[model samples]
Target: MRFIFAFLAMGLLTIASCEDDGGDSVISLNEGAVPNILKVTGSNTFIDLIALESGEETTINFTVDKGQGNIASMDVVLFYKTGTTVYRTVLESNLTTFPKAYSLTQFDIIEAFTELNSAADFQVGDVLSVSADITLTNGSKLNILNNDATPNFGQDIANSAVYKVFQNYIVSCPSDLGGTYDFVSINIGEPGGFVVPGPETGTVTFTDNGGGVYAISDGSFGGWEALYGPPGASGVTLIDICNTLSFGGSDDYGDTYTISNVTTSGSNLSFSWSNTYGEYGSTTLTRTDGTDWPDLTN
Candidate 1:
């Protein structure tokens, strides 16, 4: 996907250093205590499916404990599983404008998934996992919240809200195919200013079993890196791929990246990867048919 920001004027201000204020509190999972609410909602794809099928006719109700004070805003990262593999999408929401009495609040927000084909791509049995990171404009406190095994396509599921205190959380979705078959896209976005050795460019090869399994590799990486599963399996996890590559090394931080987006069409796939902390540079790879997957070591 292209990095075309609708507001380029805000570009310079977008890249801010992540603050490590000691005021940020980490919640212990055993505490059973609730955190402040800045933002809350389902996955981006969940919202997309709801909007497309229900026409914004759905309402999510939940309340925040506030812990100590009001939460001004929050951001959430949602994950979905295709067989055993997991992909993620991000959503941001602000709820400070709402009435702040320790009661449930309802609101609507957009869940954009321009990459997926349609709402039918998801189903009921599938899971919608959520992780929220909250921030308050006035205080130095941060809340990190996490939830798993959240059911889909119902009002009861909408009523559940996982609360926490801070500005960052990571959610994991277990194996939830939802009875939909989709492809994974691989696209390399624009390189950041701190990229070393500049941006690298190459081609990615994806081969569908004509079923669900797919094999993907980039010539830049020297060999085919099986993406979905083993050479013959139907799905592969993100951890599997990262572990296969052993991303982090003592001297070669410039060889690893964090994949941000992944989408696929028929036998075609497109995904994007960004350099993390001066790690591996960025590269764009095109797909080739019938050709053997490229080697990654060279």
Candidate 2:
């Protein structure tokens, strides 16, 4: 009877060790048997979506480290999706070392996308994803970002706070139109309809409101403040989307505005504005930074 009891205890232990719940919830002590991840660490991972001829370049600086070894060689592939089509280009291959420094330039990105037969050259708001086509030591192939039944790593590992492999870069035109400007405006509305101090000449400031938006020191190009008093027509801001300028948020008097006829010359920006309150002004804001204002459209 003692021998039978010992045999039953050993059988139960074996059954528990080999249990196959066949789900992600299954836990085992042999986690080390899982495939390792490729960790990337860096901060400069975005491409600025400026004109190709603008000489603007983004330098992606990051170090890739193989977690738990076993990787023989890998190919770093650049990928982007357009509509239902996914395009890919090999940026580097035959990487067999750990803690490799991956430095890429914006032109490199352009070349990769161009090589992949991109319908149109990369544009703002496009995303570029990087993945590794790894060759394991035991003669097996694995893609770091493959979404299949037998993925190289689980979500907890993929989205691991410490060990990360996936990387995504967004093509964006970062806009920064903040600082004081030489402002001038001519009021052209009805006489008593929000009168302005004729050809108002003063400096206005564009306070960055983040994400390509700015709050103007004087909403009506100093017209409201010159006539109505302090804090006149506040809460108005400029929304710049890919150099297309527009107005956002109503004024203190709940009056919305529209901008048109925007023109740029050197570092000067001029436009015409009209408010819902029947006030209109032709304004010019010259940049103090000596940098040309982006050619903006309504």
Candidate 3:
């Protein structure tokens, strides 16, 4: 019931079970003790999500114990939202043991989208919610949503009990943009130095500046807009919060260029970029594979 990481990821949450004494096997008004979400040692309370690369899997561990009652089972579920309504789907369910772990793979997420039933494809813009519930043998349910009297020792569920959102990343391609490359213009016939040939081997750096932000490597646009160039070329581009590769900046010549439509092939990167005061050209950068990258900051 709290917001932590904002995306699907390769990490898991571990749950530990409580001892069952088999005393009072009924839900009472005075039932006080609740299960707790174990925090990682010396880390913040936030849970890291899984980005789910190809052939990736992560196991989530949790436990459910009825202190004075007989243990029933625990259900860890996943939910996705559509418009204003939310749909509930079970990721894992019915665990009646201590220190239980449920592992999910990329195939699991794909199955969540289209499996025995035809759910919509999990795209880059979709959000899913994951939560767990413990049903006691006495027919009572307990989860993060059910508020305790003092709101005592528990997980960081946000105000008013809302499930955390999991962002689905269908494509990142961020790493593909980093490498040594040779840039050439697709269409000549324009000025702004869209003709020069030297400097064919420039470096492009991709750094994850935390929170989906990154610093793109320096370059000159056909020797036009230089990020790090000769004589007072002091303009750097920051890939904004949306994690898009689109950005516009002015060169030392005071000329501006809008960069967009960035894509990559097998060691070849191409994008349709244009100078505002000059001409539009499709620039291609053929990257030299396995080039040593500068130390990056996450």
Candidate 4:
């Protein structure tokens, strides 16, 4: 009985040793296993990625995950073209700590692109590339090479690890409103108010008066003399917390007027104008400068 029992135990041990779980859940070193990239988060296309200042940083957010095992590491790479071959260098690399989230900021992408080894004389319209490559501890390359994922940004596919060939057009002082403009139209109505003579050509200039108060020059107002210099009730452009340019001025009729609903549409500046006498008007103006932007073109 003891010999039979020993033989059965030996047989059971041999069978157990031969059984393999296929390494489906965890990576097997001898099998040359690879990890699957479950998802990736990154900007695939840089549209209107404006840089207010040359050295100011633009923070980029990213997250990477794997379907099985542990995510070993991640890389945030900024790349540029050098002829037919594109050279890629890692800008950021790190080991995963639990959540596996990554963040990178380009202090000066415009300047960075200019310093590329094989970079050409590319302008604002030229394209560049950025990628976030992930690596698993199993020595597998989990990249955005596959187009089978979702399209995250600009032409990037889902679960893609790459933001390819993006061109950034840096807008210089986009919110500056100092230029000669044409009077598109004006409508003023209030209690017992007459049609004010709206100027056909008007010039608006913005002056930095310190403390977020702008000294405005309105060439269309008839009371050009009394429009300013009254302290709190003077001609001024106050930039509210919302960055809206609000014009406060007085006309020849001693009527306090303010343009509050200001907006810029391409080459036109339009706004809703109102007065203390309950008069309201919609006024639109177009830049007179031969270029689309009078103040910026020069």
Instruction: Using TM-score, give the best candidate's number.
Output: 2
Ranking by TM-score: 2, 3, 4, 1
Over 4 Å off, model 4: 1-175, 196-200, 219-234, 238-242, 248-257, 290-298
lDDT by residue (205-259, candidate 1, tens digit) is 4442211112333322321122212222111212212112212111111233444
Model 4: how far residue 276 lies from native, Å = 1.8
How many clashes does each candidate structure show, in the order listed? 28, 0, 10, 4
lDDT of 3 by residue, 1-298 (tens): 0012311211332222133345444323244423333322332111123333333343323323333334476665555544444556666678666544444444565576433232223333234444455676778666533221112222323211222212122122233233345666554223434443333334455454332333445434344333213432224343332235554334433345566676655656566665554545566666566443222221
Residue 259's lDDT in candidate 2? 94
Q: What is the C-alpha RMSD of each candidate to the true structure, in Å?
A: 16.1, 17.9, 16.7, 24.1
lDDT by residue for model 2 (127-224), tens? 56766676768875656554321235543454345554656565546677888999888864533554554787888888975546688877888776
Number of the top candidate by lDDT?
Answer: 2
Model 3: runs farther than 4 Å from truth?
Answer: 1-71, 82-85, 113-120, 143-298
In model 3, the Cα lDDT at residue 102 comes to 40
CA lDDT scores, all candidates in order? 0.32, 0.64, 0.41, 0.41
86 Cα displacement, candidate 4 (Å): 56
